[model samples]
Target: MSRFKRGAHVDSRAGFRQEKEDCPVPYGLLKAARKSGQLKSIRAVLMYLGSVPHSVWRLNIDTPQEAQQNLSFGAADLTKLLLSSNKLQSLSEDVKLLPSLVVLDIHDNQLSSLPDSIRDLEQLQKLILSHNKLTQLPSGLWRLTNLRCLHLQQNLIEQIPQDSGQLVHLDDLDLSNNHLMDIPESLANLKNLVALNLSCNKLKSLPPAISEMKNLRMLDCSRNQIESIPPVLAQMESLEQLYLRHNKLRFLPELHCCKTLKELHCGNNQIEVLEADHLKHLSALSFLALRDNKVKNLPEEITLLQGLEHLDLTNNDISSLPCGLGTLPKLKSLALEGNPLRTIRRDLLTKGTGELLKYLRSRIQEEPKTAMTLPSQAKINVHAIKTLKTLDYSEMNKTHQDKSMTTNRGCCRKATKMEEILLGESFLSFDLCKYRMLAFIKIKRGLFRFP
Candidate 1:
């Protein structure tokens, strides 16, 4: 303790503050090297760590020991390593030191190559190396059998090794935005893959062998030069979503066998017609996107899509729609714009999906007078409802009051959400909104009917 009074200034005292050298915290690699206690190896490791950027040098150490004791980052304990957005030019072979690593993300870097030693990471489950400049992947990369998810998008890779099928456990593989004009036949061996993205590539066609991946759920081949799809693709039992936009396809393959398919996007193609056989088996389909195509009309069987939600037919050549489509229980968004639709007026088309469905339903409620307009060769054999003297709309609603009353607030919200997806369209007209309010009010008044 100083003998000076408490008010004395430090500047007045000689050598007021003692200086100390700044020592940075010991990161993982350095600490582990120090723990080994081999002077020569320690010197070599320290020099390597000193040269490495701060990102990977930390080794993502999660636990610590006493400050005086060197910490050994156990390979088993370092299960995850994230070195993204670090501008890393190269990781070299040192990454193999972390054999127990389960997740390694090095995206958005300048890596021109990867070390073949990466195959040593047998326990790695997810490896993200997207947004790099690598034109090729090391042969050893395919041998990582335990890998589950591998993302190599936005790379210059023109080819993939045939051995890529060795990754049996992989479920998600995104190789989009690459220069791959063709993929290897062995890619079909990834049977466990659930989601495969090959979008924005130079692929002129997809291999029919890919249909062998029975477990694939979502397959995106959009923005390619593909002019056709393999008929066998419809045989995939687990396929749910298929995207083939921005292609040169003139027609769709019959997917009658793919019952599990939910969404099929084939926008910006040259499909001039949609066959009923192609739409019939897609019973589970919800969103059917056929925008910017040459489709002249929709098949009457389109009404078979009972679960259908959003139907995007923008910029097509369609002139009419099936009245039965309005009868679909889940039918909601109906996008119809930029088409040469002569059957529907401009003002009515601009009114949006809800009003269009309502109009179609009203047309359905009318008596069918088409028999008088059709030619004798196209004779239709049908009994008119008026000729049968069936009950009218009000009569049916009165009998089915229970069903009408069951239309709860949840159903109304579903309608609102469905209308929200009608891209770039005007909202419901005032009369339409008023009619909905009246229907709900009718429920409260104990006279509920279907809206």
Candidate 2:
């Protein structure tokens, strides 16, 4: 007889024994095997029934039936045990008796602790403890070195033991939405770790030793109280996606060596300045965000980011932009909303980024150059009259008074063609006391001289 036992999947009206009109062998099968009979135990009972036709084990057992089992799955035939949502306060110690167990899911239970005998199941590879009231893990949990996936999220846990680093084979660790104040330094010992999430915590800084994780590719430390990112993070050559949003960072640390960084999200911070040298080094950076900060200007050196594809500068105080930013060849999505700049036409807001960039490019290209002409009075008259308009009498008077007082103002005015006027449509604006009389006399052949 096989030592494995499987439970029955039957409704409330399940028949235990067939009444009068049945074959004797079928009647024997309908009867529950007596403890002292051929099936002495549940395992032998399942083995004897294995020869029966059309028998399926119970998989979707409700709370009533599960409670009847009392969270006990001592049957060796049980390779997968799911006791989730059974309203059990704790797991039975008999769980360790199942030596062949491979997957165990007791999530969504009210258990605040685990049986110390859990370590006996050396074959257990996956454990789910999410939605539990566990504040700390079992001390023997690290002994399960075969664990490849562990889900401990949404718990009241406040700290992780330094011994957690013993899980060297762990490739993914999620500790989000907890009350953790800091991460253990032993975490750096997990050199094979590929993804880590530390969001929604109070971590002020990360251990500098984290740079040793050469295989780490995704890191999320957002929604923390971190004030500064250590410059050593820049040396993480394999890092690809870094999320540092919702922190108190005031400036971007020099990331000259993060050559593989592709997506950087640093929004919702106090960053106010971006150094041109720092930007020139991010050759591989594609998606950049500086939203909801106090950034005021974009350096022309940003044009050197040849691979830049998406730039988000929404909700900042940037009043103007460097003209060359529009000519970036690879730029695809550019967000400039909620800024104070009116550099682009006011009506262009509804048109979108492409239209705005094109408008700025057109504006720069069509910018009129102040025409330079001959040094003769004729050209001087046209140039001065066109450039200077509605002269400030008070300013001129103060200048003249200062000249008379300083005694060299007249000498200064004689050296420069102090002022001039020219003919134009429906306007005869002139600075009479200075260039006014000079231009008039020159055109009149010195007819009305001011000597």
Candidate 3:
């Protein structure tokens, strides 16, 4: 006899065996097999048992009553559970039964707190609770050593537990849009953290220990009350992108050690100076944004950033720009709008970035070369005049020639008329007059002239 015939009973209402009904076997086929005695082998019994694990479950977008009732199901084999977008205000303590659970997504819910039993899930790796009314996290949350990603953004959370750094395996964390006043120094213990977002918070300052996160790659602290950045931030060699927009910083921190930094955003601040030391070591920088600041001038050293691609200095007190700005090779986007720039025309600036960069480059090529050439030519002319004075010449003619050369005009007519009486010897007077005529010619053309 088949296993279904020996141990399973047919439900008369559904006209099929209870066990085979839920299986994929057809009711008529099972009836025919029973009638012919064909279901007699162990291989026939294994065909009805499917090979799919019942470990994943989703109770999203369901009514609160329905979600609560589903929780009664056994949780021994559960590995992933998604309860997002529901009306759940509380999680049952029975969640601790799922010791094997690894992923729990409860975002977009009305959860204001989590059950203390949550820490019992030692295998939990990801916990998402964003867009909720959480004002604080449970202390037991710090015990989850295997947790890799935690997103608690868009919450009313005012403080983070100092022991949060215990989750050393955390690779991504987002705490933006909260009322956080400060961060815990212990966060530096998350040595494996890769990305961190703390934007739109009330943070007044950052912990100096933040530099301990040597493996961090991206950090966003924008829209906060931060007054300054810790100098040790330059020690984070893996840092690639940093955002400090809409803060109260008055000066840019020196980043001489951040050789791998690629992008920096410090817009909407009170920064007034951009000194050489501030930009000297960011050789790999590609984007720099300083819009809406009090900066008045750009240092000549800014030209040292050969890899810079975009420069934003909009709405500043800058009145002039260094001509070297036009020589950067990789510059593609240059924003200078809303500045008090006096040298460049407003109409030309309105034409766009391309025209502005082109104009700056043209200034470099148009620098007057004549200023460098004039001094050398002047020295040669002076030497030639000194040699001419050593030649034979009468005192009367020589004095007339010196006065004419000093006045930069030909007094030859006066000299020739004076020679009629001053030097009556015809041959001597003729040669002297001829030499004076040639000197006048040379002075007229500016080849050799006396002051």
Cα lDDT tens digits, model 2, 1-451, are 7788777776666587654333133323222221111211232332333221121121122122334767643222445555455455666566665555566776676778787778776776777777778887877777777666677766778988998888888777778767789888888988888888888888899989888788888899999999998888877788888898999999886777778888889999999998876686677889998899889889766776778889999999988876657677678888888999867666786687687677666764565223222211110122223333222222122212322212232222332343433322212132335444343322323323366
Candidate order (TM-score): 1, 3, 2
Tell me which residue pairs clash in candidate 2: 419-435
Residue ranges of candidate 3 with Cα displaced over 4 Å: 1-76, 368-451
C-alpha local distance difference test of each model: 0.71, 0.64, 0.71
Candidate ranking (lDDT, best to worst): 1, 3, 2
Query: 1-451 in candidate 3: lDDT tens per residue?
Result: 5656475886668754455425533434333333342321222322334211111112111133323667532212446655666555777676776676678777776778888888888999999999888988888788989999999999999988888989999999999999999999999999999999999999999998999999998999999999899999889898889999999999997777788889999999999999887886787899999999999999867776888999999999999998879878899999988889999988988887788888988986666221111110011122223213222222223322333233234323333322121221111212344344233221113233358
Error of 2 at 152 (Å): 2.4
lDDT of 1 by residue, 1-451 (tens): 9997688555755565433222233455544533442111223322333323332334434334543367434332456666666556788687776676788887887889999999989989999999999999999899899999999999999999889989989999999999999989899999999999999999999889999999999999999999989898888999999999999999987786788999999999999998877886788999999999999988766776878999999999888887867777787788888887776778988787788888788887684432122111121222221222111122122322322212231112223311111101111111224123222211122333357
Of models 2 and 3, which has the larger TM-score? Answer: 3
2 against 3, candidate with superior lDDT? 3
Clashing pairs in 3: none
